[model samples]
Target: MSSGGYKPVVNTVRHSITTVSKRKRSSISEPSNNHEPVVVHRPHTSLAPPGSSRKPSKSSRRRRRVRKERSSSSVDRQWVFSASNFRNLKDKLVLVSYNLLGVDNASNHMDLYYNILPQHLDWSRRKHLICKEISRYNATILCLQEVDRFDDLDSLLKNRGFQGVHKRRTGEASDGCSIFWKEKLFKLLHHEEIEFDRFGMRNNVAQLCVLEMNCEDPESKLCMQSSEQTCTSPRRLVVGNIHVLFNPKRGDIKLGQVRLLLEKAYKLSQEWGNIPVAIAGDLNSTPNSAIYDFVASADLDTRLHDRRQISGQSELDTKRSPFRNQHAVSASQTNEWSQEELQLATGGQATTHVRHQLMLNSAYAGVPGTLRTRDQCGEPLATTCHSRFQGTVDYIWHTKELVPVRVLETLPTDVLRRTGGLPSEKWGSDHLAIACELAFMGEGC
Candidate 1:
């Protein structure tokens, strides 16, 4: 998109898509069925050198929430909430999930924090605010990825009457998935987690957990063979949480991991009475990719198994390294996207929607005709904002049987850009957390 003509469009509806990041960063593909596709491109390399001489203003500095070095004792701090203090979980079920980035002190993009956005650099403050954001939602379940400090997170929420399950990447110090739920409202019936250390790839993991909801009334209108109160079986839900591999070059691996996850979930669901399910994660795959659609696909084979592999072919390159080879850049992310890629990426939102139509549906898919660009929080849909990658990579999807009620409030694009894409003074995490409320189709309050 050209600066002379392109602009981000904000849908008036609450569940509107705040698409097009303008000049601040990142491009998106708007695929259409008949006409040529519209493409929004991402900023590949740094545009300017650091320290150009101008200093930041007070208001700009004030906008940031800073935390000075304090006692390390807060890490040891713990709180315990009484049973009466817990939120009512039966009436509403909100799930919030985020890629907390990580606890690594030295990262490739870490320099950008000090050199460019100095005011937005505070790891201690960022951690606190990330926990605060998670608490504010008071969601029924919290699925967190890129959680290096699982112990700290577990400790933080433990006092709030929440229990967590963590699975670290094999042979890595950090980088893992953590799933937390209110102890009083849910009981873990079964758990299956996989570490995708296959295909000579870096470690990535997916976790599936079956939770039985603790209903106050035995007859709390559960979904079973009979809609009667005769069955004493508790209501159940299956949740899939993942931190998908990030190499655009190894899309094959990403697709395979997703397919394995879906297949596992399907088999587990079938063995467990075909329970309702919800999947939350940092997929790395864009909304238009075939893998994104395949998550909800009931009968689709893995992209690796398909004889005629389609979708994302605009990006299939033999020269591309198995990993993100800086020496071998993917033209789609760095340079001008080809017309065919644009047609795949920028085709009108409707065309992608039609292709993405699946057995399961996104909680925030919204009505027909609109693209699946709305975040679970109903804010600007972009989940990630960084110098390298800025787009919606996080999602909350539920089976069609679980009707979506509403999405939580998320950070607006204007506010998000102010901090220059996450790890901001306002919110923690480079990847924005997303949440939505869901209810059983036939169950009424």
Candidate 2:
């Protein structure tokens, strides 16, 4: 499929997904409403150097709450709220997931961002805006995707007490994923990178890191070593970062990439004494999608779905296209998988289903969504918005060992519409940043 094509338009109303950890599933009507497809064109890449001559003023910083009077100023004042009801918990850990729009990608895909102001597209200004937004969170862990300018980001974050590792994509793609942590908070024990092309999937990549907290207090150490432990063994966590493929037509590859990521997360968790795990990034799949179902349920019968519709992106184009008919045709055809794809995606024979061992849950689960900000699923109404598309594709999923305390708020659709799409003069990326505060179970959570 060409990189340039009409982008599918997602419906506004969506059903919420139940917590997969409880082995529950929620069913909803198949996508029946669709808007006109947005036309997109391929444009030449702009290879501009980083512009960092000027600095932003104090007023340029973001405000915690959104204001009714919107402006073209660099400061972002979007409404922010905790997921569901807010709770004050002790020893809470904050994790943030963001996809920093890559400099090269921004230039190459200018057509999709035509509605955005040109000044907002400048790498220099955007870099400052991105850093300022991140500083406000003061997150202990950050899982970032589409980070092409690692050195610049690292330098900015390093001063804020964060040390990070970056992994570039396997092919010509300039960006990949990065995992950063505050130096005083955690010690990195193990790190690994995943290049999906090696597994015959694609050029996309993922990062896994095992972090152990610093126990500086002598009394805390004694408590951990004592026969009566205060909490779980060793303050440790396993974090996974990934940027799944965006090609909606290649659901086979998407499933395979995610499967490998989960497998790796489980392996690392076991190796590190089955510690708590947090996986964050842009999965490029929507809530309640077949791929999402498999992620939540840890099992999927591939035969039940059409390979192309597995990600649910095709459903967004149902109005103008014959997606329903195509789905039926694809489902009836036999042998949809090649031996390589079958093994990579399902980790077994082409005729079998896919399953994973780790019991995972979305951090946003159990929270209620308002009509303007999220679906009943408690997921953001739209995490990414641009000229061609607007929908929720980013998430932070966690294992049962941790309990969610609060989650960062996502912007309402009306706010995004007012901005004329993202990477605007205010916000730095097309996607909104998601964050969650979590505490280890049985540790005063």
Candidate 3:
């Protein structure tokens, strides 16, 4: 027989099966005569109770009704606080970003150095400090860059009672970005890691998270002391976390990478349909750099412009505000200050500095009252002389669909000590984590 003719005959025999149960017996029988096998169909009705109606019972009807109601209720609840519901998120969501300097394994004295480490000091310890700082602000979403491995971060958040979704490493610097959320509040739908060659270095872009906020009803009224109900604003928002390359040697390279990152984010936004996005991260370059322009020009519309409001310097008059020359300061000056110096001098407040060049080129400059800082913990050391000249290197940008209710930098003392400390054998990473909280106006993002 030809191959095709024999193939179908073999398949017909292979599909035959026979089973005998209390209620029924099923089988495929073949005739002794050299003819094709036949498939017989039979269904026993003995399983039915005596006099039972073939139609469903009243209780089954009730169950079906309840199941439908439950399914609809779940969808309504989800839609009630979708990304579109929240037009402004000043106090609803918080986003954080930090660089975890890769782990150093060169030390030979593993016993003394590694053993004394706190149980939490492992990846979990560092992630705990970060999550703890984030929890302080009640952050809903967090973005971390330069993660050594996905496992290290998973272990950290797992230990802290938090869950995270991360992308696989692509190239050199197996370094990647990840996002963690309060699982009780948000659900992750999709995640992917993107890599592109820029200049000569290989850079990575991680796009992860589809968040849903457990928001309060904006139209719902709160009962007043007099028994009358007053309307309250909506709560809940959606956000995106990103980490762009910072290496200045390859401006063109970084610019291209930024373009690719924005492309991916824009595609996600379209796929999500009407969902607002907040992109946060340690963009290696400040807002003034071309890379920032590339991101700002993407489908994302900047809801808040750059602002310089000094913290801890409340005692200092407006004339002494370190943020005064925020626009005038050069990239060189911003780089000269250490994270510790910026934290101490700002009185635990951090600044967001954009490129003066972009301000000069665009009409979006001079958005007043937009710039602000939050308090950092711990007292300044007397030996450290004066606080560092601080400016905004980190950032929080939002879409027009979402409004900014409150955006501030978070710098807890313990986090500062861990991130600002010089590269040491004990610490898991460098760079203080910056966090922000935003409130929604109508529906949750």
Candidate 4:
């Protein structure tokens, strides 16, 4: 497979498998509430006649049943608590994005400390700490970018109670992407890698897992058996995690990349039918930029909430109503507006609801100091740009079918260095991490 730049061969194979899997999985599951029979086809046998001798051996049958029982047992254990409750539904699904800085390579470093332990420590502490925080949310799936190699990432996550599948090859200069999940929550059915152009970078796109959600009511068993509800069976959901090119700063190139990503996602959504889809990464573009516009236009939801609006509303209305002047004006002039109306207009948007903002630098600066302190926790700060435009470029987007329950930006910190007695300025990576909570429409897609 091509590493840094695009390779047509890799793209073709990955796209083909993704398409085939989508069709096959849809065929196996029943249609949604719409009653549109979307059937995914499986491998069929070519027969010499109607009753040709092609029966499976007794040993093969036994193995198949044993495998099925093992797989079912694993899934059942993951949801046994919910099975016992039978009245409470799981509320949220979380997704996280982290950039694992370039892996430690001998050629890149000359000093022993920086060469041997720095890279290894950064990988072990920084990356795994980030992973631990993500796991706290009980995220069903995670999309990670800028991973050095499949083995390193897999080893790290596997050690931390998570299972992952890496789609890229090793020894390549630029790192590829990966998806890690709780083994109990998702089953890996298929995966592939896609390249953007004939000479562009090779990217990964995988149908990594299917999450089975437990039903709340015991009587609901009959509902699933009857197949009357659209999402009767708790099945799999499709997740596409990717990292696009950072150079060639032209709008058209970035827009084209966004289009390609969305096209792939749309195809998967069609094949997966009613399964909510999410695409997350460092798109390297701001929310107002054309690249972001192209992505938003594709109908895939993004987690870019406006921080300015969120903070302004929270401070002015929720706490103390910044509209005292408006209230006074209304009282003196006998205006038709009430205190609530004045507050609504002067305080900005409503405070009860916090919309998704593009967590940019400007937004971060505007956040209350207390909250900022809580987010940072006494770490040395690193700028996004060397001197200018230091803000959030990373983001998480979701499909309309999914609702964002909560979103947070993992603060950059020198905890690794400080705890290790190293300089406080040292950081694991250049970009901040973005995380979000999503409510799946049905049990599982």
Predicted structure with the largest lDDT when compared to the true one:
2
Clashing pairs in 2: none
Candidates 2 and 3: which is better by TM-score? 2
Worst 10 residues of 2 by lDDT: 1-10
Taking the tens digit of each residue's C-alpha lDDT, what string does model 3 give over 271-296? 76645566666555544433445444
- Residues 343-400 of candidate 2 have per-residue lDDT tens digits of 8778776455888877877776534335666665667768888766778889888887
C-alpha lDDT of candidate 3 relative to the true structure: 0.40
Q: Please give each candidate's TM-score.
A: 0.64, 0.76, 0.48, 0.50
lDDT (CA) for every model shown? 0.57, 0.72, 0.40, 0.41
Candidate 1: stretches off by over 4 Å: 1-92, 105-108, 111-121, 198-201, 216-231, 296-358, 367-380, 443-445
For 386-439, candidate 4 gives per-residue lDDT tens digits of 111233345566654555443443332222111221111233454545555555
- Clashes in each model (backbone N, CA, C under 3 Å)? 13, 0, 29, 21
Tens-digit per-residue lDDT, 1-445, candidate 1: 1011112224422322323332334343555675443655666444347755454557634433221111111111111111121232334466888888786732645743442245444556667777887777767788999888888888878877789899988875467999998887778999988877653335888899998776653443223234354436556778889988766655555655665676677677778887788888988765555566566454433322221222232233345432111222333443333333323332332322112222466654532111223433222346766544445667777775565555553444444443444565465667777776666653432
- On TM-score, the candidate that comes out on top is 2
Query: What lDDT score goes with residue 313 in model 2?
Result: 62
Candidate 2, residue 405: the lDDT equals 68
What's model 2's overall lDDT?
0.72
Compared to the true structure, candidate 4 yields what TM-score?
A: 0.50
